[model samples]
Target chain A: AQSVTQLDSQVPVFEEAPVELRCNYSSSVSVYLFWYVQYPNQGLQLLLKYLSGSTLVKGINGFEAEFNKSQTSFHLRKPSVHISDTAEYFCAVSVLHNQGGKLIFGQGTELSVKP
Target chain B: GAGVSQSPRYKVAKRGQDVALRCDPISGHVSLFWYQQALGQGPEFLTYFQNEAQLDKSGLPSDRFFAERPEGSVSTLKIQRTQQEDSAVYLCASSLAQGRTEAFFGQGTRLTVV
Candidate 1:
């Protein structure tokens, strides 16, 4: 019923450069959006979440994403990234159900920052 | 515990063998979740538990997969007759409440079926 699409399978950027990871979702009803980051051999950590708030959401590590309803997009952006920012990013959606909300995730985008 | 913890950081099983993955959620967490992450793919929800009750299990890929949170604090996902397709990282997560709460994740157990 609900699905997420991440346009970029991988993104390579130089250190101190700006980067954006694109995400789009298709849902029939209202949804909650989130971005998660996973470093090598570690669990996923929440970067940001868009519940019922402003379109622009700021997250950890100077990352931000704007929820565009019309475009069905929630693209993650960073003004300047460092070498440590290399990780896999995922876009996920959750809709309230009778039991509870379950997360449906997109195919992740691997962000590679080079010196 | 400070965060969700999963046991058997790595497991190697021969094809057709059975395997069991364990999860220890944060104490007092009301919600626990199980997910499967394949190579180069995001984690996929496998099941959900509220306390000791299994509220949702629709995401399980097959009947061979079984899960239980008998006491609510600890949960286990058992796979019978493991196959190569079942090789993946099994993640365990916990949340303080049922809805709209942040879910904390574990490092995950990497299962490899040969």
Candidate 2:
């Protein structure tokens, strides 16, 4: 079985400040990792995904995450954040070759960017 | 049509009442998925369908929960004898293919069982 763990339940940062949302996963086999953002009353949107290739993945809204296999982590980072960046972020993993491609998600981290 | 869409943005059902939630995936999407999101929790997988065939339903919580995608384009999740614990946001997602593709999600239907 695969599982995701988000270290922080909530993160508060001032506008233009850098932020990092930490995520760790436990899986017996290789997996695909993803970060998703959800704004109030809206559906979740993919922020970034790490399938293959480079370990560092960049996404929309100036967000980026680095997949560290040794650490079993995929932490999302933003050099600078805006008030509009406040949303709920989720870390997810999918086992490779799984027929359904079902995603296992973490508890989620609430990112609050205040001006 | 342009994106995944779920009907009844909000639903209130009395305890013991049955409810049905609808999802319309993007046109021509080959894979559809259903998920349940509880308050302050991440969404959990409920079921998966591929072109009118239900390929996986292991995530369904109980037999009271039923889902179907008959034509593959549209799907429905039915809950029998709703309970307070059943209150949650039901989300529908679709992808162009089954594996390694990005899944697009709908706004979701908020179901409240009183």
Candidate 3:
């Protein structure tokens, strides 16, 4: 079983300021990590994912996440944020060996970018 | 590309009423998944289907909740007796079934049980 935790329920930042959304996971086996964003009244869109080979994963909209094995953390970050980047962010994990593995998601962090 | 799409973007039902939500995955995607998202929460896995076969359903909350993807393209989630607790946005997603591919999602159907 795998579980994800996004420490911040809500993060408020001014436009052009850097922001980081914290995510941590617990899993007994090797896993894959992912970050997703959801706009108002929309479904989740894949922001980034961390599989094998690379601990640093980049996604669309200039966002990126670092997967830390020792810390069990995969935090999403961007050098700067825009008002358009305001949305609900989620972190998810999937089993690497379990073919039937399903994504387990976090409670979510609402990123509010104010101008 | 036209992303995943769902029908009846919003639905309202009285308690004990049956409701059906529909999802259409991207064309030719082999894997489909259903999730439930309560307001202010992330989506929770509900079920998974690979092709026309149901591979997993561990996340369905109750026997009243059922999902089917008969032809492996469009899927339907049927709630036998909708309850207030069932009020949430039902999301559908599809992936390539290849290595490390990301899942694309539909806008989701919001079910309101009054």
The DockQ scores of all candidates, in the order shown, are 0.76, 0.77, 0.65
Clash tally, candidates in order: 0, 0, 0
Q: Tell me, what's the RMSD of every candidate?
A: 0.9, 0.8, 1.2
- Provide the TM-score of the second chain in candidate 3: 0.96
Off by over 4 Å in 2: none
Docking verdict class for candidate 3: medium
Worst 10 contiguous positions by lDDT, candidate 3 chain A = A94-103
Give candidate 1 misplaced runs (Cα > 4 Å).
Answer: none
Taken in order, the candidates have interface RMSDs of 1.2, 1.2, 1.9
The complex in candidate 1 yields a DockQ of: 0.76
Worst 10 residues of 3 chain B by lDDT: B95-104
lDDT string, candidate 2, A2-63, tens digits: 99999999999999999999999999888999999999988999999999999999999999
Tens-place lDDT digits, model 1, residues A5-97:
999999999999999999999999999999999999999999999998799999999999999999999999999999999999999998866
Find the number of clashing residue pairs for candidate 3. Answer: 0
By lDDT, the better pick of 1 and 3 is 1
lDDT tens readout by residue for model 3, A1-115: 7899999999999999999999999998898899999999988988999988889989999999999999999999999999999999999998735455578899999999999
